[model samples]
Target: MIVFNEDGCIKCGACQGTCPTSTITVTPTYIQHCDMCGQDPKCAEVCPEGALKVEMFTVDENALDQPRLTFNSSLCTSCGKCEEVCPQETCVVVGKPNMEVEGFCVMCKKCVEICPVQVIGIPGIVEPKDCAIDLEGKGATYIVNCVGCGTCVEPCPVDAITLDKVGGTISIDENVCIKCGVCSQTCPWNAVFISEKYPVKREKDIIDFAFDSTSCIGCNTCVEACPGNFIKTIGSNLTIEVPDICAACGLCVKVCPTDSLDLVVKWGEAHPADAEGLGYDAEKCEFIGACANKCPTEAIRVVTKTGMACPSLVQTDEDPSFVNCIRCGACAAVCPEGALTVGSIEKMIDGKLVMRDRIEFNPSKCTKCGDCETACPYNMIHLTDDEKLPVKGFCTLCGQCIEACPEHALYDK
Candidate 1:
């Protein structure tokens, strides 16, 4: 039998997991004595404090790789404190009740600190839990201290939000809320926000932004108006790097006097480093009009120039309008040529529909084939040898050039 120093043991459960024979048991408060493995016991070898040991025996220098965290079902009261604190989505500890620390675990150890019964433990490292995950870039739309102003009520496509006028509070019906973030976008008081959450490491999608630097009047309006401070004046030109942290509020887009900047926001996703940089182009479009036929709102129109395919909105007898686009991503989803991409995809999460409210264009994917130039009804776009397809002033910024390109390179951002 092996001896356990009760005074020195921290109950981290490292030894029990490291035991080669599975002869050791550990709990939050106590550890069962080991059988010593009849030699230099692995349990004693891994014990952080040398609390477990055989009489007059010295263990080997090398330690075996073991599970970083161990669970004691007997000690777990289903208190749900571990799931509340852990940042990883892979290791869910509440509903599933298993902290499988693989793939996504960054070893932040938030569960260790919040466990009420001290049931959660990290072996070998007895140090305090790390608070090092950078969470500024990840978040979801949340309403804080809503004043029931009703500013956000009219813009909501679905009646998922409500205002309690008497109580001066806003309540969102999670069952009905589409998570489109229109309420978060329309809130004037900045009460409804994409508030920060625990940092879960995810493969981020980049933001699509466009700035017409040639037409820029060197005005400082955008730099001063930006609330996120993402836009700055670089020499005589304006440069903006809107990454994941941007709130997608469109303040800078509204403030720019020259109409130089265009940003079609994909709320709650990361933006790319350069808006004009590379885009996802592995998929090509045959322009067979599937996206046009798939559009529920009749918003997409397919046209071909010299066998090159592009997408545009079906023209109505009335004014040019894309206000009907629900952003269902049906066009993008059905496109065999892979020409169209929606701002986001609709997902069901916690019984609520999380949908993309807009679509963004990417320019790096442009092939410079003059398809957009030929497709331009007003003939505003010109393909220069030294530059990408540059649009001239008095441009309508329509979807024509976007639809004309076979490569799907131009973005309306």
Candidate 2:
């Protein structure tokens, strides 16, 4: 049967939803266990944390077999109180306290009552011939820093990867995993690094990268602009090692003060590499319904957002102009991952509200202190020779200039 480590569970309902047998159930604050699915249990597969696990057990014939004691590590401080009170010295080891020692624990309740933090817990005693749970036999384990992308779940040949409904990360059932290394190679974040033990290796992509240190002033602009966090500045020297996870977004290239960094995308020449009007990146999108929820025209549709199982999509390119889209930047503004980039801005053009830049210019509050020009990471905002604010270059709508303006001149359109 599948049981939960109550302290570790976040009550996300990931396991309950994935259970094929519909045995698992979850409430706002409580979670109920389920009978194991016999085959690879789906409940264990989707658990983001390794709080839930499967254990094989047989009914103990002896009536005196004591109930297993569960430990709460969150409330434990290693006070050694349980160790001092527990009659069996083998039961309560200093750091690794094992409350359930077969034939050792006499159920004196001395450790339970003396625990200052109440970490030692004893559940109801099981009747004779009941399931004797062996808690130490939990078969699942999770790697550190799992991004909960659910990418590993699909590649597992044995279906050992867990799916996290909470959009956190995934856990792997070590017992079910064949160590084939498919999940390790498929993971974009390298959350599963067990591939090193096997022959599986990720193919290297052809990339053309260039950085001129002579022109670079070490202003730390590229580090701040890069969304992938591929660039790092140490004193005056910049370190760029983005072969594995670089999206090639060119935010670093645009924010470079001296035009020192240059990157060429070998796959596609386009900067965004998407359709003109409403650009969307499926790889970066988490299907959180932020764009579809905020889209005024209802142009974008996500299948997962509507509780559909398949055919997850945004919008088609049939209407590249996005005629229904008001270009209000509502979708782009609300998108958490910046997946949806609107091409047109909502502004008056020939008495028509065409898609235009979302940025607004207020000349009344303009002090022209040149702070906006300095604050613009993309170097888009600048003061003309006559000291007039001239926004000539491409604006990413990053809102850096708005924060930099002391007079509160700039505001979102």
Put down candidate 2 lDDT per residue, 158-247, tens digits, no spaces.
787886552455777654654444665455343454412211223323266578877777677777655334565666354443332243
lDDT of each: 0.40, 0.40
Q: Looking at model 2, report the run of 10 residues with the lowest lDDT sum.
A: 267-276
- Each model's TM-score? 0.24, 0.19
Candidate 1, clashing residue pairs?
A: 206-272, 207-271, 207-272, 262-413, 284-337, 285-337, 310-403, 311-403, 365-409, 366-409
| Angstrom error at residue 311, model 2 | 32
Q: What value of lDDT does candidate 2 attain over all alpha carbons? A: 0.40
The clash count for each model shown is: 10, 10
Q: How many backbone clashes does candidate 1 have?
A: 10
